[model samples]
Target: MRLIKLDATASTNTFLKELAKSGYLDDFTVVWAKNQTRGRGQMDGNWCTEPGKNLTFSVLKKMEGFQLNKHFELNMAVSLAVFRTLDLLKIPRITVKWPNDIMSGSHKICGILIENSIVGISLKSVIIGIGLNVNQSYFPGNPKASSLYNKTGILYDLEELLHSLMQNLEITLSMLQSGQEKVIHREYHSILFRKGVASTFKSGDGSTFNGIILGVGNEGKLRIRLEDDSLAEYDIKEITLLY
Candidate 1:
């Protein structure tokens, strides 16, 4: 395990990807930036964070037994890891949105973006980018954003929180490496946000409709039961859950 702390950077994920390309990455290596200038979100969306007020980091995990087909299992494991860390902190109403967004009630406190390095039928490595709002109180235009201090009314030590998250991640990853696929699947859907509840979603063609989230597929696509009682599968870019 190696940790690199940066005062500022364009994006931690980008930084770590460069390291992997240089063949200098170690398993469980982490790159964290205090001020991420151009942080990323799902689908090329820009992640906006107040400098020095949040946790923006990327973890490089060498996938020893990771299969290309069971990619969503990795997502389920990582999402559960973050959920466990937040739940351990006594953060109320922790729920994982489909894929890997961690929500506190209705507001989002954390986001994860995974970049994988694939070689043939196996995944060589995976870069998990995490953006967690910690102490910042204001998100100028984003009303669905909140922080630990914003919700808990107490300031938190960023280093302490990051350490806790890493510990939880290790435990969850161990479960994954041990082939506990069923367990991970069950646990991930247990706290999934809006699961089994009717919700609005927007399609890639700019059409909106109501559907019930029916958990995720093995390949990470969101499965939804529409009004007609038919099942539909959508990849990350194909649909957006309208909160």
Candidate 2:
């Protein structure tokens, strides 16, 4: 595992993408930044953070012979790893929003973004980027964001937290490589947000419906039971949480 720390950068994910494209040797190569000038988020949103008060890092690994369709399980593995790391830190009020957001009491604590490359019939590599709010005293402008410090009332050493997160992530990836998809599936569902609760979801075409989350399907799609007793599957981009 090689840890590369940056005093300041545009974004750890961007840095890792460049390294991966350049064919960097990947076992456990991590790119981290204490401050990101242009941090990114899913759907072009900004990942706001206080410099030196959060954890922004990316993990790159070469995948061999893994099926491309199983990518969502990989996401679940990473998500559960983060959840476990926070749990070990004695933070018990965390849950994973389907597909990838870590939340505590309706406030988001972490966000994950994964990018992959495929070459012919083989999987080249995957870059898993994580942004975790660790010790920020206050979020700039959002009632929906919260940090570990705000929730726990204790500041955490960024390095120590990163180390623990990487360790857990490595373990989770190993489990996936060993064909333990059920393990990841079960654990993720156990900590899923709003399970069994009726909530509204917006489809890609902007259609909305109320349904109960029944857990995720084996293929990593969200399974929802609609009012008509019909089952619907939605990918991350195809659905938005109305709550």
Candidate 3:
């Protein structure tokens, strides 16, 4: 549970990865920054953050004996942790967009990126990076982004929010270690976007469809029921969120 705070950095994830490679990062070590100059997101998109007004951090853990195919469960656990943290702050209208985006009424509040290394059938270590909009009042050009301050009209202390986030993260990781996939799975489903509602999805092969999101499968794939009542499974890249 060691928390290292940085005044300013390029990216917390990259910093932690370098530390992990140099054997400086240990299990439960958390690295955070008040501002990120070169923040990144899924698909190489830029993660926007207001200096000293957002949550940007990385958690490093050494996991062993975990199935590689179950990595999506880790995503679920982390998303649930973020959701629960915001919930505790009494932030209403927050929901988890499938895979790992935290949204509040169609505006994104947080994003997660997970990277891992494996050594001969055992997970060496995992770096879970999170970028959350905390006290920022507005985004420059991203209309789909929102912050806790914008929603609640009250600013949050960065350190206090980080403490709450780490506590939830520890609990979620413990549940994963204890084979409690059902706990995160249920929570994730409960907050899933477009649940039981018709939505448009674009697949990797350039095909689009109108389908309903039933729930994620045990293997962590998106389970969609098409208009014809046919069930289909999609990996992260296989489908794009259209809402």
Each candidate structure's TM-score, on Cα atoms with residue i matched to residue i, is 0.96, 0.95, 0.96
**lDDT tens digits, residue span 60-174, model 3:** 9878887788888999999999999999999978889989999988899999999888877667789999999988887878888899999999989988999999999999989
Alpha-carbon error at 121 in model 2, in Å? Answer: 4.4
lDDT of 2 by residue, 65-97 (tens): 878888889889999999999988887589999
Better of 1 and 2 by TM-score: 1
Candidate 1, residues 1-243: lDDT per residue as tens digits? Answer: 689999999999999999889866678999999999899898889998999989999999989557888888888899999999999889999999887889999999999999999898899889999999999999999999999898899899999999989998888988999878889999998999999999999998999999999998888899999999999999977888996
Worst 10-residue stretch by lDDT in candidate 1?
64-73
Best by lDDT: 1
Off by over 4 Å in 2: none
With candidate 3 superimposed using the best TM-score fit, by how many Å does residue 68's alpha carbon deviate from the native?
0.7
